[model samples]
Target: MATEVTTLVEETSAVKPNGGVTLPIYMDNHATTPVDPRVLEEMLPYFTGKFGNAASRNHSFGWAGEEAVETARERIAKLIGATTKEIVFTSGATESDNLAIKGVAEMYREKGNHIITAVTEHKAVLDTCKRLEKYGYRVTYLPVQKDGLVDLDDLKRAIDDKTILVTIMAANNEIGVLQPIAEIGKLCHEKGVIFHTDATQAVGKVPIDVAKQNLDLVSISAHKMYGPKGVGALYVRRKSPRVQLSPIIDGGGHERGMRSGTLNVAAGIPSACRVAR
Candidate 1:
């Protein structure tokens, strides 16, 4: 069965035309995936005829672009069991992870100066936490089991009154090990610490219900899920305990002022549609 599955995946990703290798056979899906044809079709108009800044509120072209962006947001939100208002678009998961980590650290500085995370996290996460350490934040890097799964008891013991966030990845990028996200989320909520997950490798491939899992923040990437590159979103929980963050990129107060810049309407809309579909 494993052999059959591997063959099927290879066939689906590339075709050996004329008994020669495909020019670009991609096996590193953890890094990115080729854009689905359906998503490409959806992205074409935004790049060509419907090109307009989503922030431009006075013109018809802008309105159309804004409408498309909002629809995409709704689609992405529905797919992940989150509200449209909670989704903040960004360039990709690295930015999303940075935003979720640094934003939370800055916003909650007065409340706490400690964060807990597993050692085997994406560089986006580990690097962000490292930067925070330079600024006086204490980070606890929990050790994982032999199978690359974090020990829940270790995580529980690491929590202190000064701990403010628990950041973990939903799936391992290289090894494809699935973490216990729902369990971690529950644990964080019980301790009054915010739970954030870099869901780039897990978003479309696995089931994620932010509400059910009690996730406070989630980072996602479009390219990881058969969508266009350079587009992603961060889901910030709005109720039960509203999650707040400081904007990493300050400009025109876009994305509820969490991320401010001209929206990438062209790639973003198609990315969202791919996730929803």
Candidate 2:
């Protein structure tokens, strides 16, 4: 049976209001974006004949599915200045933030039980720190300056021998303020702590070079960049102090055992589109 679809979004750039402003306008792009037509066009094949489980190893169907994911990954890697192997797909930035924080905390528990982040960080990060506190881990929620940027001096003072990870966001989703990610990454590297940035609002809009910034892990979302929802990726540095994470999920061991789930074949390609092939 063929199901009819509704066209909710206006394809035209914008409709003018009654001499006020654009009508039917989506004001907060920081939160999300309508999927681009190009992305949708690219993803149509996978839902039909190309449909297959990426985890299936013996069939041509599986091969097609895996190729789509890999191609999508290559585009994601290129957008963020990362290697294809460094990208780990996830449900979204929230999960990416959790994986980066909790993964580091659990994997290096013997080394340290302390983590640091800013007061202005995304809830995924700040709340994860709070949860860690309940688990007997120490957390430092650094204060932001009047301009809404993390205080570098405060951050330096907060880093102690036990601090294992530092999670900060590259851009503020609410205020649209840019953080000093480069400086923070350099500082974290000097202090020998892992640096994770929620670049959901920054990746496609700005130039973020993981190596140049000395960043260890970066969280990226597709919906924020005119792609679809329900998918995201994390960049975990592989060398120059390869970052390790303890898997929060356990099953088929997809996503290199970090996040285990049947890869969202259709949603993934478009979700990571523009960021994907």
Candidate 3:
């Protein structure tokens, strides 16, 4: 069955542009996937005719672009059991992970200076935690079991009154090990610590209901889910101790002031559209 799936993917992934690679990375789903032709069709017009800044609020072109972007947010949100208002568009999962981690660290600095995460987390996460460590924020890197699962007891012990956030990956990109994200989230909530999951490798492959899982923030990547690269989102919980974050790329106060800059109308819309379809 795996061989058959790989063969099918190879057949469709034939666009080796400029003698580059066209692999779908079947062996490792962390890389990228070919954009669906249908998704491309849905996105073409924005690049040509309807291209306008979503931040612009006084014209029809801008309105159309803004509408498309919002629709895409709704599509992406619905897939992961979140609301449209909770979605904050980003460059990709790396940025999402950074925003979720550093954002929490900065916003909650007065409340806590400690964070807990598994050693098996993605570099996007590990690196972000490292950046925080430089600023004197204490981080606890919980060791995983030999079987590549995080020890829940270790995580429970790591969380202290000074712990602000606990980030764990939903799935290991390298070894395909699924982590206990729901359990981790439940534990964090019990201790009044925010829970973040880098769900880039698990969003499309597994079921994720933010409410059910009690996730405070979720990092997602477009390319990891068979969509275009360079675009993703961070799901920030609203209400019930609403998650707050300091913007990393501050500019035009876009994306609820969590992420700033002009929205990528064409690519952003189809990336989420592909996953929803």
What are the Cα lDDT values of the candidates? 0.90, 0.86, 0.87
How does residue 102 of candidate 2 score in lDDT? 93
Task: Predict model 1's lDDT versus the native.
Answer: 0.90
Highest lDDT: which candidate? 1
Candidate 3 has its poorest 10 consecutive residues by lDDT at 268-277
Give per-residue CA lDDT, model 3, range 1-277, as digits (tens).
Answer: 9999999887787655655756543564467766766777788889979998888899999999998898888888888888999999999999999999999999999998999998888899999999899999999999999999999999988989899999999988888899988999898888899999999888878888899999999998887766778898899999676999988899989998999989988865445444544
lDDT, candidate 1, 1-277, per-residue tens: 9999999998877666745878466578787787877788788899889998988899999998899899888888888899899999999999999999999999999999999998999999999999999999999999999999999999999999999999999999989999999999999999899999999998888888898888999998888888888888999999888999999999989999999989988875445455445
Which 10 residues in a row give candidate 2 its minimum summed lDDT? 1-10
Which of the two candidates, 1 or 3, achieves a greater TM-score against the reference? 1
Candidate 1 clashes: the total is 0
Candidates 1 and 2, the one with greater lDDT: 1
Per-prediction backbone clash count = 0, 1, 0
RMSD of each: 6.8, 3.8, 6.8
